[model samples]
Target: MKYVTRTCYLGQISILSVAITLTCVSPNVVSAATPTLGCDDSMKTAFKPDGNTTVLLVKKVKKDDPYPSPSKEQQIFPNRPARFAADLCWVKLLVGPGVPGPTGAPSTSRGIGIEVWLPEKNAWNHRVHALGGGGWANGYEETVVGRMSVGNGNLPAPRIAAEEGAVTATTDSGQQYAGASFAMNPDGTVNVAGWRDWSYRSLYEQAVKTKALATAYYGSPPNYSYFEGGSGGGRQALHVAQNLPEQYDGIVSIRAGASTTSDIAQLYPELLVLRDLGGKAPSREQLEAVSAAAVAACDIVAGQHLGFILDIRRCRYDPTKDAAVLCRSDGGTNGTPTCMTSAQALVMNKVWYGLTIDGSVPDPALDNGWDAPVTGVRIWYGYPRGGYIRSLQGDLTWPEMKSGGPDIIALALGNPKIGTPDFKNATANGEDGWKTLTYAELAAAYQSFRAMQSETGGDPDYNSDLTRLKISGAKLLQVNGLHDPSAWVQGLTEYYDRVMAKMGGPASVQAYYKMFVVPGMSHGYFSGAANPNANPPVPADGQLYRALVDWVEKGVSPDSMVFTSPAPGSESSVYKIYPHPHGPQMSLPACAYPTVATYFSGDIFKAQSYKCR
Candidate 1:
């Protein structure tokens, strides 16, 4: 919606005086400063718009300083051209060529100055739609626009323009800060203002504004609108669906968290555990041992020939008993494999479980690949202790490896917890309660990693508002990579369950939501032979993005999309897409809730390999 600036406190005048003055003023009196338009001339020109849909060319400002100043370090690789900085300014760009209509030529408009992406267009018979991306905290106006250009060669406004032959606008949440405000200091400390602006409020505000802008630009409200994002962006998709459902007709949240706090909190426990190990780096032996133990525990359940636990839901390890085997390897040289020590095992277990220190049992249905035992060669480990030493450069020195532990620990402690209701009661038994520590302790630790999280601003209880999102008629599609190493796939499932519970149950939530699990995809996208060391590859049958589009546009709800590995031939270029039934069944009916996929009959290598329920 178009924003109008109103002076809330002019020279500290009392509200009563302002109200009285307003009553006495003429109805036509105008006093606010005129809105500015256009960017500097030195930069590339993108279109800027006044509150109305009028378009003008504006110079772009770089999001950050061209070079690292004394306050900031230089970007490691500055390959991309610098961007325009539009902090607090209002700018607009023209997307797509104007088309002559019955009345006049129609042009699409978008806001560029603020962090959000807003697109709008006006045509009598046309419609308007807004798209949301993941990581609302991160500055994505450029990224989203760039990706759109690369993938579909149409900016959001133009894409929507082409799709519906209607006008459209998108936003980057009008935030000045990049997502969250917390940036690490040169010495690796958190920056505060950076943190607060980057919190959930930015994304929430973006969603709200998208609807407002739609109403303002179109004269009439959008007939139908959709929100889409994957991973962190997926979380934004869920947030809109859960918190502002009536605003949009469809939402595609691919791999979103149920609670932002819980998701972030879950990473710390493992980081803490790893830090306690006090090694320069886990020896090759240690990595192998932990990987091996993990596989043995859950690989069979994955029903894959690779012998790795492809999912996290099925992993079931008793920390007390599995702890020993988990850390059989500890300190060793780079060349030699070593057994994990007790302390090391504890850390690995915690990492596998996420940062949740509480006693809440993990959902049995989520097949976390943590339990897969490491039998094959270890590909790599996290940053070597001292600094980033490229693998191609050779093994890192012991002292260098050791240097990373403290920082890793600090990051673990300081990371923000994913906000979820389950976390509140995690440690109910006094000192032994599931979550045990107070919110203050967690906040302080999170400050150490990224100080912006300590601001305690934004809607911490946003996840609890799913009912409101549903009431608004939002549809959600959640996707996750089963083998995601960054955020556990289990966490995504946990978030989905929380939404279902908040809405009563699966059947009740079914009208608004759907979840899909990608077999071999990584955190971002499918990595293949071009990037062998990537975390996960899209299976032979996966077409995750296409599936999302189909669900959003064609009204064909995805039950299960197929995944296959690339064969050694030209035909291997083609993907095989399959559909699995939704809900529990005897023969691996992608079971719901507590039911897990377990082997019942037939050869494990075949699609008839196992059953879930």
Candidate 2:
């Protein structure tokens, strides 16, 4: 059959089509069937837009296909028929009968959420395009279609699918709890059922069902499949590439979290330290100032201070050496520019060290100012390291251990004798005395805090069986801002190293994965400097997404990408694209683990000024 190609332009919106034809005898071709509309009798309630609404489209399929039979590995239940759902602005297509629920009853089938963009007219040239990331729950089918629209306005999926002459879908990964943990839960008991359902199984099932639904709906399967996402969504993209390589021709995983479990565990130690150091809850302004000062002090070396610590690798601010700036005690009071106190520094030191009391410090060379000793000056610099400190009132004395609870107030004002020697030292060192408090105690305290803060569960290593991904020949790109204290860039680096190690070594893993470290970007693309006008709304502007698209479609890997703080009320911005580190031979070699960017020549502020080897 001949299909006409058409182009439609609506202001900034442009839809272009290329001519194509389809033969009737193609493998897996299906006759066009009209969509049936009926309310589920069991769920006999009027559909309301108040909560999320899902519409299921079912297509009968002949049994003779090459799709994988449900297996223990795939975790999919037996195949029933082809069924797909149309949610707001997206499609959830599935291929199986249904999986067993927590009660062992046949549960509603779960599948991937693919965005379908159809042109106004039917044509054989229709293709499939995959949209990528924005946290697990943030990116919606509507958001992606809107961005691709001509003038940055929302476009309905049906019109888009028709206009692009394509059917597209995204994977919600089964049970829809945002992250995997929530998806696997069925029981009130820590929601374990949702967690299991959401893992790799949901993703796999969605892929299979999406293809089936497309073929059933369009009378032909998708011509091509693509995957894209950043951060948590990036992790989902990696899952597809690894587990279902054949499901997609091109995969874009930007800033993907390869080892999310480890990342969460790592944050625990830091959180504990902050809690112990009297920094549980500081105002946003206080946190911002503290972060700014740390960036300033650590942005450069003594001779070449860059006024910003874009690259944590080059920062060498030793708390012992630059004591005034690194370990001040002003506590954001009395007009002090710093954000931390000595006690807080000790807590942060403990947190950054993973709460391990082995006394082995992180390599100072790679530590930046992150692992510096806690000092009073550093306390006023940012969020307190150990936790929040409460003001002592009226001859405070230590409360009994059991009665004191986990509150910082008891630690601050309770019996002085019960406290550690470092606490005493902090009180004695004039203003900076609190800096000497040992992090060891705080680390132990987290045992109780962990029990109190959240429910407990067994440590489940999601990456334990990454062999499927490895065999699938998926490529991964991970990027993190060096100055990001939220999920500290070091954690991402560490995760990459661990994944490589598990896969044998860099030689074995290099082809499948790579990581890029952005020097100056903050968490969610916030600004590193203190300028409010310069801060750009993060995860916007498609910087990370563009990088992934380039890598996947063009085979052009990004050694470095550019980032800049937007100028206030101006279209122009100061941007810089950092390059991969160069060796003495001037060869651009990938950075080895545990090392950061170092400047051998030029100005430290410029990315061209240094190399990471």
Best by TM-score: 2
Tens-digit lDDT string for candidate 1 (412-461): 34322321111111112012122334323443443343322223222222
Model 2: per-residue Cα lDDT over 254-307, one tens digit each? 445443323323333334444464445433344444444455565445374443
lDDT of 2 at 100: 43
For model 1 the TM-score comes to 0.54
lDDT of 1 at 321: 50
Each candidate: how many clashes?
A: 114, 83
Error of 2 at 231 (Å): 2.8
* CA lDDT of every candidate: 0.36, 0.37
